[model samples]
Target: MTTRMNEYKQQIITDFNSRINYDNEFRYRFAKPLIELAQLKPGQRVLDVATGTGIVAIAAAKIVGDAGYVLGVDISTGMLAQAQRKVELEKLQNIELLEADADDLNFDDNSFDVIFCSAAIAYLTDVFTSLCQWYRFLNTGGIVAFSCFAETAHTASILFREKAQIYGITVPNPNATLGNPEKCQYLLQQVGFQNIKVVTQQFGFYLNDAESAWNANANSAYGYQVFQLPPDKLAQLKTEYIAEIHASSTEQGFWHDVNSLFVFARKS
Candidate 1:
């Protein structure tokens, strides 16, 4: 990997490691839909890329039964440790957790019957190339499924980026590459996947107050870009972001749109 790419991966590892103690209920919910889209069968080999906490992997193991196997790979040892503990507690002998980068995985061609990546594809340095790698690892007619957010989703992050631009600082949108259903379809098609399908679902909610929204955005991976700023500038950005949130708030509260897209395709 290039020096910049290596640094990016390190950043991701650090970010996730720090989140080991945080509640993963959101990720668990996000991964469940991908499991349904995968439609895994008994005895089918499965791969879960960036399988943080092994939520999807463990679920897949249950559905696939004892005859099948699951390999959940992640870059964060801290996350993997949590996953391992869960697997052990469940007594799931069919699942294996590995500490590895999703982009650098190596396996024989047609090694898996199903592949899943739940809400973690955006962290990839090269989304298309990674999808193509998954395509090569799947058996003919095998399915690959993943979930991502729409560009318009996460109003807080969107507004933060907009406000940051006024300060001459550019914040990258993680969902820019595969934000919509159409973009997801085109990507799978280009990777030689057939029987493609993209499902859109709104999991939007209202934050109780502007402070809640600000805290959510500031503590997330999206906030990494602004961390390098001077403390005064960062504080100013947070203040401006909170003001924008208040301006946009409704009677219910600040709306945070979790517009999710579940994309599935077959390697044919």
Candidate 2:
């Protein structure tokens, strides 16, 4: 990762944290699959890495019942605050929230029965390094599950790349950690995770109208690159992107599509 890429990613995280409220729509679209992939069991010890607003942690707490425990970790304090509030509101004593970097967890070896990461994997500067840490955290026979946006499934990202070319904005190369399932598999194998399996799925959000489409993009990773542009240019980009979405939408509504891959592996 070059300095340029790191800067770009920081800007993205900052913008996304600011704009995207944890709504029911987001939980249904992103958290549902992650929960399913986690295959949680009662009395299991689960670690929710990059836990964001704590949706998956909360879900895991329920699935694991009173005997189980869920630990949620995130780098962003704001996101963790929201997660803690949810914990308090739900009176969930089993879930613990912490502010920690995913790549370098401060825990003893083989501490967790299962570890789960969601869309935050794409933002990792070195996903392989983080995956290695996760591998170390799992007890023997324990599994690690995560969901990431597959590069193949991100139509908006591709569209943004094309648009960046047309507009002469010097957007950096796509993050190496993004939506490529084959590469992800190889990285997992390299980290000594066995019985690896990867599955791809598509989720589409049909915006109520063009305005809703604009709002979603503005709050998402795809739009972060163009977010800091001058107001007029930003407006122009939004308008053009909205038009592109409207033109490509299905009968349901304007479609914002992303490809997410579920990966599961074990420390042998």
Q: Specify the highest-TM-score model's number.
A: 1
Clash numbers, per candidate: 0, 2
Highest-scoring model, lDDT: 1
Candidate 2 lDDT at 258 equals: 68
lDDT of 2 by residue, 20-55 (tens): 476577665677876787688899999998888898
- Compute each candidate's TM-score over C-alphas: 0.93, 0.84
- Tell me how candidate 2 scores on lDDT: 0.76
Runs off by more than 4 Å, candidate 2: 1-13, 170-180, 211-222, 227-235
Per-residue lDDT of candidate 1, residues 79-129 (tens digit): 999999999999999999998988789999999999999889998878999
Please give the distance, in angstroms, between residue 193's alpha carbon in candidate 1 and its true position after superposition: 0.5
- Candidate 2 lDDT score at position 225: 56
Model 1 clashing-pair count: 0
